[model samples]
Every structure is written in C-alpha cells, then in structure tokens.
Target chain A: MVQLGRRYGTGPSSLAEIALDEDLPRAYLEQLVTSLRDAGLVVSTRGAHGGYELGAPPSEIRMSDVLRALEGPIAPMICATDDPAHLLGCDRSARCTVNVLWVRVRDAISGTLDSMTLADLVPARNITLDPRDPTASPAGVA
Target chain B: MVQLGRRYGTGPSSLAEIALDEDLPRAYLEQLVTSLRDAGLVVSTRGAHGGYELGAPPSEIRMSDVLRALEGPIAPMICATDDPAHLLGCDRSARCTVNVLWVRVRDAISGTLDSMTLADLVPARNITLDPRDPTASPAGVA
Candidate 1:
C-alpha cells in the first residue's frame, strides 16, 4: 500500500500488474488489496482495465498507517500496548519492569514509522549514490 | 520470545503457568518453546515439577538474539535485511531510490533492540520514578 501510494497516488493499477512486478502471488495480492480498500487506504475499480490505487496522497500516508492496516499494532509486547484497559489475565503491570522498556521501544518504533510518509519513499527529485566507494554517498541533483 | 525468555529467565515455568501468565495457548507455547529450545534459547527439564528456563542469563541475551531465535530478521522491507539477502524484489543498492531509507530504518530498530541487554529489563535496584504516580516519568534513567 505504501509503495502504491507513493507510485500512483490517486491513480488506478491492475492487481495482476502489481503482483507480477512485485513477485507476489496474485491471489494474496487480491485479498490484500481488498483489505486496503476496506481500510479506505485505497480504492478499486471492478470493470475491464480497473484495478487498485491509493485513496489519499502520498504525503498523507504514514508507514504506521500501512502497517496497522496489514499487521495490527507494531507492539513487540502485549503488555506494552495502548489498549491496556482490556488486558486479560495479566494484572501484573504494576510490577512489570520490562513493560516500561517495551513501551519505549514501541513508542520509538511507532514514532519512526509514523514520521515517514509515503512521499519520503518517493522523493520529488532524483539522486545519486556511490556504493563501492566507502566514503562516497548519494547526492541529489536536479 | 522475548517475553518468554524473560519469564523463563526468572525460573523454570510450567506450560500452564506460561499460558496463564502470557495469555497464550499451552499447545502454541509448546511449539514456541520447542523452537526456542532447539535454538538453545531455552532448556527443558522433565518430571512433575519440571518445565523450561532460559539457557543463559538475562544479561547475556539481546532482543535480536531472542527475535532470531523465535521469528527471523526484523527488517520491515526484505531488501533492507542483512542476514537474508535480496529478499525484497527491488534492488535499492543498484537502482531503487528509497532503498537507503529502508536500510536506515532497519538499522535504527535493530541497533536499539540489540544494545539493550535483558538485564536492563530486570527491575532497577533504585526506583527512579514514583510507583504511585501513574503519569510519573522516570528521570535521569536510560
């Protein structure tokens, strides 16, 4: 979804094309697209030449959005989750020292992923980077 | 597996105890424990009072170690991963523009998790924050 959001923002794409190009299964991609569509992250057209596309702009799509759509929460620990009110069989939060660390890790992961938008993935301009030269790095040029 | 590692690290715990405490099924946990034991993260002891415990101390374990023992690499994008190479369909090193970003994110997550030892999770000797204050944030503590 993030890739599509960046690539063809508000444009349509055939499921088969994306699957073939991405080397993913068509059936699985189809189901994934359906879920994305339901999440309002994307829209799909059903007629001939119809396909899937982002419903929002690339700048509006965060990695967290895509991740939550696909994999629920990014939490590494259940006790460190946001929905602590619904905790089941685990009332040991008061003494759970590890919970604090997990919370930090969770927040850090969330913050980093949320900070990155789809637009970040698809920069407005082209760039160049030297891989072989240890000190050489990519420098953007118009 | 980190949770399991910490739990078992404290002491050998029965399957029923792990299930009740972790909110996971005994059958599923059995499979997970088997995998961990095979990976040397855990060791099993048999008999009426026997169960499983961490093979090593909390100080010796890293989150990455536990993660690799349970799941696999922590890369958000397959191409960003180090251990398993070229998993992502796109070759960012040679062509893709956004590959560096993925690599950076992957490294950041891994570095943070890997730097903290399991001992860091064991409750601190000196309580930095007031246990009574729900909103109290720890100060001068890492």
Candidate 2:
C-alpha cells in the first residue's frame, strides 16, 4: 500500500516493480492486490503495459478503511469489535465487567487508524512532523 | 487480570473458581498465571484454598506492562516495535517511511493501555470516567 501510495499519479506500476522496490514477494503482492482491488483501495488496469494504482489519492484513503479491507475488523478480543454489527458472543458478557476496557482499546485503535491516511505514510511528500509525535525520532532527521 | 483484580482484597481464588467465573479453561489459566507470576503481575499461593492474586494493587498495574509481559513488545510492523531493544530486522528499513506510522500506532496503543489499570475494569468500585471516552457507551449506563 505504501508503495502504491508513493507511485500514485505517476501511472500504474507492475507488481514485479513494487515487489522489487519493497522487498516483498511478487506472489504475495499478487494475492494482496486482489483484495485491495476488490475493496476499491486499488484499481487495476489490464493490458501489456498496465498494472495497479491507488483507487483514490493517498490523502483520501483512510488507513482504517484499508486495514478493515485487508484484516476484516480491528479487535483486541473476540468480545470487543469496532464494528457494532460483527461483535462475537462472549459468555462473559453478562458478568464481564472488563468488557468496557477491551471496548476502550478497540476504540483507541480505531481512532488512531482513522486519524491517518496513506499520504501520511508515503515518504514522497514533505510531511510536517507533529512535534508531539513520539515516532518522530531524531534518527529520521538528517 | 480482571478476575484477580476483582478478588484483590479477598485473599486468593482457586483456578477452578476463576475458570468458572471467566469461562476459561483451567489449564490455560494455569499456564497464563505462571507467566504473569514471573512478570510480578500475579502471585500464587499453595494449599487447599490456594490460587492467584495480583502482585500489586490493581491501580498500580498498568495494562501496557501487563500486555508487554504477556505478549512481548508491541509493534504494528516488524520494523517498528515499541521497545528499542527488540526491533526486528526489516529489509526495507532504509526506506520504510511507513515505519513511523506503525510507531505512532504503537504509541497510541501504549498510551491507551497505560491510561488504564485493572482497577478501571473492576466494577466493584466506582470509576469516574472521562467525558471524552468514546467507549463509555449508553449501554454501559444502566
């Protein structure tokens, strides 16, 4: 996804190119792109010179939706899910006072995922780092 | 942890009792308790009424430490672990701009986990929740 985000608007790149650039197996990319395409996160153009591109601009693609498309739903436990419709039954629900904690965890994960887009991960842009970002390591600076 | 938290001041709970209360297999709890005990998250007793208890008060036990003890370091990707000591090798480390996003995610998860303790999950006591907690649902009101 990050590879595709970087190549956005530059024209579709073949899986072989992405695989080589990202050091991932082309076979894995083949399987992954299918899911991403099915989820409308990527668009495939078929032909001799055609391949895959981001379905939308990087900035418009929320990581939450991309993750849900790839991984189903973000859940810390079977009893707690971000999706209201897909919550699994837990025998402890009736007496599980800790369910709220798992729910809070799920919400936190969902909120973080929602706050990011593919553009945030694509290195091609001059991203202004948030001063409060703990991930903004001094190592990342020249 | 929640089970032990609930029984904090009540001495100890036999694995059988806790297995029944949480609907978990006693054998799994047996193994899990050993790991928690080694992490100083739980203490064990031996005798007819012996079982496990929290090593410290519930409020003193951070979920982040508990999770780290149980699950090792938190990382959204192999290259972006929360702990600096245990970063996994990644072929793309040199150009993995997406690594920072995973670090942000780890930080978010750690922050949320650290903000909570077993006390927050133990319903035996009153907890004044923040108004901004999205997981504080109306269903939890009654």
Candidate 3:
C-alpha cells in the first residue's frame, strides 16, 4: 500500500513491477491484486501504460480496511468472529468463558489497525539530527 | 486452563473428563496437555487417581503466558516476530514500511492478553445487577 501510495500519481504500476520491488511472488501478487481490485482498494487499467493504482489517496485508506480486504475480518479465534452475527454459530457463545477475552483481543487488534493509515507507513526520507539540540548528535559524531 | 483452574484442589482431573466437559476430542486434549505440561502451566500426577492440575493459581497465570506456551509468540506478521532475531529472516527489515504498524498491533494484542488472567475467564457463579444503575436489569426484569 505504501509503495503504491508513493507512485500513485506517477502512473499505474504493473504487478510485475510491484512484485519485483516488494520481493513478493508475482503469482501471489496477481491473486492479491485481484482481491484488492474486487475490494475497490485498487483499480486496474488495460493496454499500454496500464497497470494498477490505489482507488483513493493513501491517507484515506486505513490499514484496517486493507487488512480486511486482504485477510477478511480480524478474527483471532474461530469463535471470535469479527461480526456479532457470526457468534451465533458457536454453541457456547452464550456462556463461553474466554469469549470476552477473545473479543477484547480482536477489538484491540482491529482498533490499532484502524488507527493507522497508509500514509503512516510511508517511509520518511532524509531524516537529519536536530542541530539546535545539544544531544542530537552521537558522542563519536560532531 | 479454565477447566483445570475450576478443578484445582478438587483432585487432578483426567483428560477424558476434561475433554467430555469441554466437548473437545480426547486425542486433541492429550496433545494439548502435553504442551501445557511441558510449558509448566499444568502438572500431571501418577497412579489410579492421578490426572492433571494447574501448576499455579488462576490469578497468577496470565493469558499471554498460556498463549505463548501453546501457540508460540503472538506475531501479527512474518516480519514482526516477537523475537528480534527472527526479524532477520525478512530482507526488508531495514526499511519495511509496515513493520512498525505490525509491531504496534502485536503489542496491542499482547497487552490485552497479558492484562487478562485465567481468573478473569473463570466462569462467574452469579452475576448481579448494579443496584445503583436502574438500566442494569433486563427490560422485563424488575
């Protein structure tokens, strides 16, 4: 997502290029991109100068959304499905001792993922020490 | 763990009994008990009346420790292994854009699990309504 964000407006990036750059299998990337496209996270173009691009700006795309699109709901346990409706499938849901714990865990994970955006994962460039701060530089440096 | 905690001091409970009560396969329970015993979470006894019991009190055993013992470290991603050494397997550790996000997620999950203990999951016998809170009772209940 961060890589696509970086090259968003430049042009659509090919699956081959993304796979190569990300060091992921091209076949896996193909399957993943199909899901991403289906989820409306990315759009594909056909013909020359065509490839894939984010459906929206990186900042607008939360990590939670991407994760859900790729991995389904963030369920840590079979009985702790992300949807409350799914809990009905578990016979012990009415009195499951550990259900609450799993729910809390799932919520914590989902909350953290939701709180982050693709923009947050974009690497900062040319980070330099604060010259005005006396302790900014290492002992061996300057 | 909960079952063992509930049965603590009531004499060691056999795998067959625990499996029947928990509706889990005896074979599966046997394998799980081995791991639990090896992790020092549960102790076994020998003889006709021998079975298994929690190694420690429920309150003293955090869910995080049990999960780690049974499932290994709670890693949210391949690059976000709980052990720093395992991160070396990922070539992009030096500049993986999503590594920090995954670490935060892993921490959030671990924090939640660590905060809960076996005591918390032990089924409450009788949950009473808050006397000061009128809405605490069910709609049809007084």
Candidate 4:
C-alpha cells in the first residue's frame, strides 16, 4: 500500500513493477491488489499499458478503511466488533463487564486508525530523519 | 482472573469451580491461569483445600500486564514492539514511515490497556445495569 501511495500520481503500476520494487513475489502482490480493487481502494485499467492505481488520493484514504478493506471488520474479540451489522451483542454481555473493556480497546484501536491517512505513511509527507542515528529527531517535525 | 478478583480475600477457588462458573473447560482455564501465575498476577496454594487466588488487589493489576502475561508482548507489528529486549527493529525501519504508524497504534492500545485494571472488569466494581435493556445506563456509572 505504501508503495502504491508513493506511486499514486505517477500512473497505474504493474504488479511486476510493484513486486520488484518491494522485493516481494509478484504472485503475492497480485492477490493483495485483488482485494484492494474489490474494496475500491484501488482502480484497475485494462489495455496494453494496463495496471492499478489508487481509487483516491493518498491524503484522503483513511488507514482504518484500508485495514478494514484488507482484513475485514475490526474486531479485538468475537464479541466486540465495530461493525453495526454484527452488533447483536455477545450472549455473556448481560453479565459480562469484560465486554466494556474490549469495547474500549476496540475504540482505542479504531480511533488511532482513524486519526491517520495513507499520506501520513507516505515518505513525502513524513519528516525525513537521519537513518543512521536512532536518537536523531528532525527539528522541523510537525 | 475476574473470578479470582471476585473471590479475592475470600479464599482460593479451585479451577473446577472457575470452570463451572465461567462455563469453560477446566483444561483451557488451566492453561490461561498458568501464564497468569508465571507472571505473578495469580498465586497457587497446594493441599486438600488448595487452589488459586489473585496475587494482588484487582485495582493494582494493570490490564496491559494481564494481557501481556496471557498473550505475549504488546506488538501491533513486529517493527513496533514495546519490549526493549526485542528492539532489533525491522530492517525496513530505516526508510519505513509505516513504523511510526504502528508505534502510534501500539501506544494507543497500550495506553488504553494501562488505563484499565482488573478491578474495572470485576462485577463488584462495575455499576450493575439492567440485563434486559441494552440502551439502559445506570445513574451511578463512573
């Protein structure tokens, strides 16, 4: 996804190019892109120069949506799901105070996920730090 | 753990009792409790009336520690682990902005987990709500 984000405006990138750039198997990339396409996170073009591109700009794509598209609904436990469709509530919820704990946890996870976008992870938007210095912090970090 | 917390200071409760109360198999609960015991969250007594009990007050035990004990370290991704012993960092960390994203997510989860304790989940400390009413909120909820 990051790789795709980097090449967002360049044009549709072939799976072979992505695989080679990311040092992963082209077959694996193909499988992932299929789900991304189905989720409308990416769009595909067909022709001689056919390939895939982001469905929206990187800055507009929430990481939460990306993760959900790839991994299905966010669920920390079977009983605690963020999806309204699955909110039948757990059978033990009546007597289960633990349900609230998982709900809080799921909210924390979802909130964090919602707070960032693909742009936050794209190198162009991140403050570049000296790779060799683990303690180094950029003065201009915003 | 909640069972032991409820039974705290009362006396140790055997796994058989916990199994029946929680409607879980004794064998499964035994495995989970073993991890808890090794983490010093619970203590076991041996003899005719031997069983297990919380090692400390429920309020004193962080849910983060409980979860870490039952599971492993708090790691949203292999690149963003809380444990210093395993801080080799991913090879891609040098150029990977995604690391920070995972770190933020891990912190969100850990912060929420740390904010809660076992007492927060135990029924004795929770405001009892009407079991039949999903929308019902107790006036004394805190």
Interface RMSD values, listed in order for every candidate: 2.4, 1.2, 0.7, 0.8
Residue B9 local lDDT, model 1: 35
lDDT (10s digit) by residue, model 1, range A6-100: 45744678888777766678999987777777778888888998888888887887867776677766776777664456334346666566666
> What's the lDDT of the predicted structure labeled candidate 2?
0.84
TM-score of 2: 0.82
Q: For candidate 3, what is the lDDT? A: 0.83
DockQ in order: 0.34, 0.57, 0.77, 0.67
What pairs collide in candidate 1? none
User: What stretches of model 3 exceed 4 Å from their correct place?
Assistant: A84-88, A125-142, B84-88, B126-142
**What fraction of the reference structure's interface contacts does model 2 contain?**
0.77
DockQ-based ranking, best first? 3, 4, 2, 1
Q: Judging by DockQ against the true structure, name the best candidate.
A: 3
Assess the local accuracy of residue A89 in candidate 4 as a C-alpha lDDT between 0 and 100: 72
Clashing pairs in 2: none
Of the two candidates 3 and 4, the one with more favorable DockQ, higher being better, is 3
B141, model 2: CA deviation in Å? Answer: 25
Badly placed stretches (over 4 Å) of model 2 are: A125-142, B125-142
- lDDT tens per residue, model 1, B55-120: 887778786677666777777677778576546665434545567666766776787788887777
True contacts kept of each: 0.45, 0.77, 0.97, 0.84
Write candidate 4's Cα lDDT for A1-142 as tens digits: 8888988888988888888877789998888888989999999998878899999999999999999888878888878898878776767777677988888989999999999999888776434376676655533455
> What is the DockQ score of candidate 1, to 2 decimals?
0.34
TM-score of each: 0.57, 0.82, 0.84, 0.85
lDDT of 2 by residue, A1-142 (tens): 9989878888989998999988889999899889899999999999888999999999999999999888887998888987778888786688878677778888888888999999888775443378666665533366
Query: On DockQ, who's better, 1 or 2?
Result: 2
- CA shift at B96, candidate 2, in angstroms? 1.4
